[model samples]
Target: MLDLAHRGARLAKEHGSSAGPPVSLLDQEVIQVSSADVVGLPMRCVFALTAMGFLPQSAETISADELIRVRISPAWLRLDARFGSVYRHRGHAALVLR
Candidate 1:
């Protein structure tokens, strides 16, 4: 799991408020780890990896079958960290992770 996986993600919440689902950064790193179709997200820099930073997801959920679906046109790629992760499914809604 990437370092970012240990932090709390402010996913699926209203904008500008300190309330939402708390996702551990250490866990939930794999939806279908072996699936080749899975898109990986990169681990951002120190500043970008802070608690104030996260892959803003507009909509994310897990089905009974455990199929993790995510939607982001411009996936996050941290060239420096060389780490990859994924944002929860959000269709096309613009969400801020900070």
Candidate 2:
């Protein structure tokens, strides 16, 4: 998932996206994460990915924390996996999580 965000930023740069990468979503900062047991982690991931344009921006007013706390549907998981794989293949496969 982090790879996807990295790849998204790379592609965005290649295609001339004007918005600079968000500080929190920077590849340097993101790659350091291995495991986290923090509350709202999923919400944070969704927010970060969406902010990077890896995931489409949502129009719904539902907060990320609320949505994640309620449920993580299988379909959403599949989408995450699909996007991760796609980005991994596109030159972000070097990420090694320990």
Candidate 3:
């Protein structure tokens, strides 16, 4: 229920076309949210809270991956936004996100 669709739209509107996917693939879809695409403050708070152990992740599917994904996705987004050129050399956005 992270509501990424809304967040993505907002991000696109805010940044306009100046900010695009940091990495692009020839024929793949990127799964991670961009830093410029997420709701800034909320993602930061989620990352902090997850790091502090207040939001413990369980071994179940949802807890295991979603928790970590949500926590790190924003960081990846930030990295992509700031250092996209560097990452693009390593791999496409989909690979990095995965």
lDDT of each: 0.33, 0.38, 0.33
lDDT of 3 at 25: 19
- Candidate 3's residue-wise lDDT over 1-98, tens digit each? 23432354455466556654222212232244444444322333333333344443332423424332322343342222111111122225455433
Please provide, for model 2 over 1-98, each residue's C-alpha lDDT reduced to its tens digit, 9 standing for 90 to 100. 44455465575466543566444444332322222321122323543546655443444633444321212232232124212311212234467789
Please name the candidate that would achieve the greatest lDDT relative to the true structure.
Answer: 2
lDDT of 2: 0.38
TM-score-based ranking: 2, 3, 1
TM-score list, all predictions:
0.20, 0.23, 0.21
In candidate 1 the C-alpha lDDT for residue 52 amounts to: 38
Tell me the spans in candidate 1 whose CA falls farther than 4 Å from its real position.
1-36, 45-50, 53-69, 74-98
List clashing residue pairs in candidate 3.
none
Q: Which stretches of model 2 miss by more than 4 angstroms?
A: 19-98
Worst 10 residues of 1 by lDDT: 77-86
Better of 1 and 2 by lDDT: 2
